[model samples]
Target: MSDPTSPIGWGIQLAKLWTSSGQTFPVRVKDIALEVTKARFPEPVGCVIPHGISGIDGMLSKRQKKKDWCISYDETVTVPGRINFTIAHELGHFLLHRQQRDTFQCGQLQMLEYDSPESRRIEAQANTFASYLLMPRNDFDAQVDGHELSFELLGHCAERYETSLTATALKWLEFTTEAAMLVVADHDEFICWTYCSQAARRIGAYKPPGEMLPAGVLEEIRSKALDARKFRRVAPGVWHPSEEAIESVIVSDQFEQMIFLVRFPFALSVDHEEEPESDAFSDLAEKIQGLR
Candidate 1:
């Protein structure tokens, strides 16, 4: 078991261990997560309870002015895999942010946004730890390499990583070379959030259909054309300014939660120099190792 004193540090070390073992991307992440948790805190770390704690997937706490620590989770969702991620998250807090606070209350979204800066830096660090520890870069790169942008492929990566579709997509965007963007939205037409790949960002591409496309661009006019299995290329200026074109595919589960993958034309090959890194996990690895 690696020390959790620095979540990023431990995550990088664990990623190296998994890579050396020849595990595949997404899959290696789950393997490393399970192995690290069982080795470090063998007892069900989810059982230790503290006062005033309400229902939640996981909790982290330390007594005032003392090094005494505790980590626990809701017994309801206490499967080994979920427990693994929870423990990893708590370990992140223990190693990275224990000085800032005695406890943290984590919901699903908070845990998902573990890499973003808007969230508490510590929380983001913890999430980054969990993500990197679970999905090592080498493995993720192999799965994504030579793969086309599609919902089915993303779903496969998600299952392999034992994470949600959004998580997998977010991770994929970290490494993909194509100009792609992911949009998550509800039935009411309100945009929940959006993430763009490095290429897409450099081209000044964004979602929500403002200034780029008229409002109701996706829902009103093109709703009938959306198909998760295939890509539809629209005319230039539909998604951005270049003579480059746009292709979009919509992924809808039964609940009406939608994931839109929009692809930009591959023109301006000169700008290829700014393409995203081949290994999405490398930046995180560098950050973690630097911390150590």
Candidate 2:
């Protein structure tokens, strides 16, 4: 076994092990976590404590100058699927970034935005590692084949991976062959962030919702009905001429947010290109495509 020091290195090495051993993704994730925990600390004390502090999902604490460490999670987060993902994310940080810092605070956006270049690269790496560890590409790809990308389908994947709907959907977009986009909006006005699949980018499907939706647009028309599940499809000019259709689903809790799943015409091609290739990229691409 190679030294599991860096997050990326550990992830790649573990992914390879899982790929060859025929272990299931979720099972492998737990096994890796257990191995890492036991290797670092003495018996009984080395175990990862679940349902960490009141509000946080997971925690990692390292005493000064010690290689041995402790990891914990909030037990109140009873959703098994979400708990699994949080564990994987925290394990990622532990393996990859613990040497640099003693404590890590994880939240929804912070966990998923791992790919953002402007932010901490290690966080993104851990996220990538966790996603792959829990939802290996081979299994994910097998599920996605012949299935139309839908909220329900994404929800199912989330259940399978023990992650949130948003997380699973974002992962789906990362690897799906379909030209799809996931847009998250807040207050039905500002576009928080947008994620486009390889195919969607090629067709020029994007959103510059411009601080607010344009007057009389479907997003604006349905703004009040923010909690609705039925997505409204708009023609090309309404969203983007290059797209064959746009479907918007809004999820309003204490915060009103929208997720747009835009589907592009199968025949059209836009100039946008795929993400640059790297070791992490290869891992993710392979995981999503179920090649591993």
Candidate 3:
């Protein structure tokens, strides 16, 4: 059981209300933000509005004189998933961290923080709260049950939950039985962040955020106009020294980043044909070996 005073607990409690009322997918967080705050506190959320802010994705501000709260999100972000998540993130602050500070100004990175131990406690808590509030466990589980995990399948879950692909992928990682990792890299092919499932971690199939993506299929996809959606079987040393992995790629023009879904099999097949290592791949392998 989740702590009733915790962020996840509060989110679950609200989600239950929507579920019990026979409400459908994509929980209307904006409506609940205003209503819940008003019902619970005197200095409730006065408004949930959009602002033309440049750098800030969302801001939760308490009016100094009026003593009321307002949740404002960037209006220029056209993606419904990003906007909705930002709104929910602000709502998380309103519910969980309103008393911690007078205001919270969040950017893109803060919104993506989920369960990182090194992330700021309050920000991660708010993100967790927003994720649960937007996509509850029972509903999310039902959507992905019995399906082979892939970027295409996750895209459907994103659409169903009205969440960004990254958010949806992270949610799946939290509960998936497969050994998989979601890697976000910049247009330059430098890794920005990574989230691995427990199974992936157990097998040491993980990479840190700052490392450059090794020269391989993922790099080739970024450099050329290849099918970004197709999953390629990458050779050993590209991702792991002894184990080969399947790599799926997607380029997000909106965020100007590449998303890679890497899945590792439980055991390496001995009979699988091996590709001859190219000069670049060999050089990369040497570099990676030196680092290890």
Best by TM-score: 3
Report how far residue 288 has shifted in candidate 1, in Å.
24
Point to the candidate with the largest lDDT: 3
- lDDT for each of the candidates? 0.58, 0.61, 0.73
lDDT of 3 by residue, 236-287 (tens): 8887776788888888786777788988875433332443322111122222
What TM-score, to 2 decimals, does candidate 1 have?
0.68
Name the regions of candidate 1 deviating beyond 4 angstroms.
1-8, 19-55, 63-69, 74-87, 109-119, 208-226, 243-256, 269-292
- RMSD to native, candidate 2: 5.9
In model 1, pairs of residues that clash are 5-95, 25-139, 25-140, 29-134, 114-124
State, as a TM-score between 0 and 1, how close model 3 is to the true structure: 0.82
**Model 2: per-residue Cα lDDT at residue 274:** 58
Span of 10 residues, lowest total lDDT, candidate 1: 283-292
Q: After superposition, how far is residue 94 of candidate 2 from its true place, in Å?
A: 1.9
Greater-lDDT candidate between 2 and 3: 3
lDDT of 3: 0.73
lDDT of 2 by residue, 1-99 (tens): 547665556656666776677765454455667675576535212446764467576666664545455667777775447667667777787776765
Error of 1 at 44 (Å): 12
Stretches > 4 Å off in candidate 2 = 3-9, 12-25, 28-31, 36-45, 63-67, 78-80, 108-119, 214-232, 246-250, 271-275, 278-292
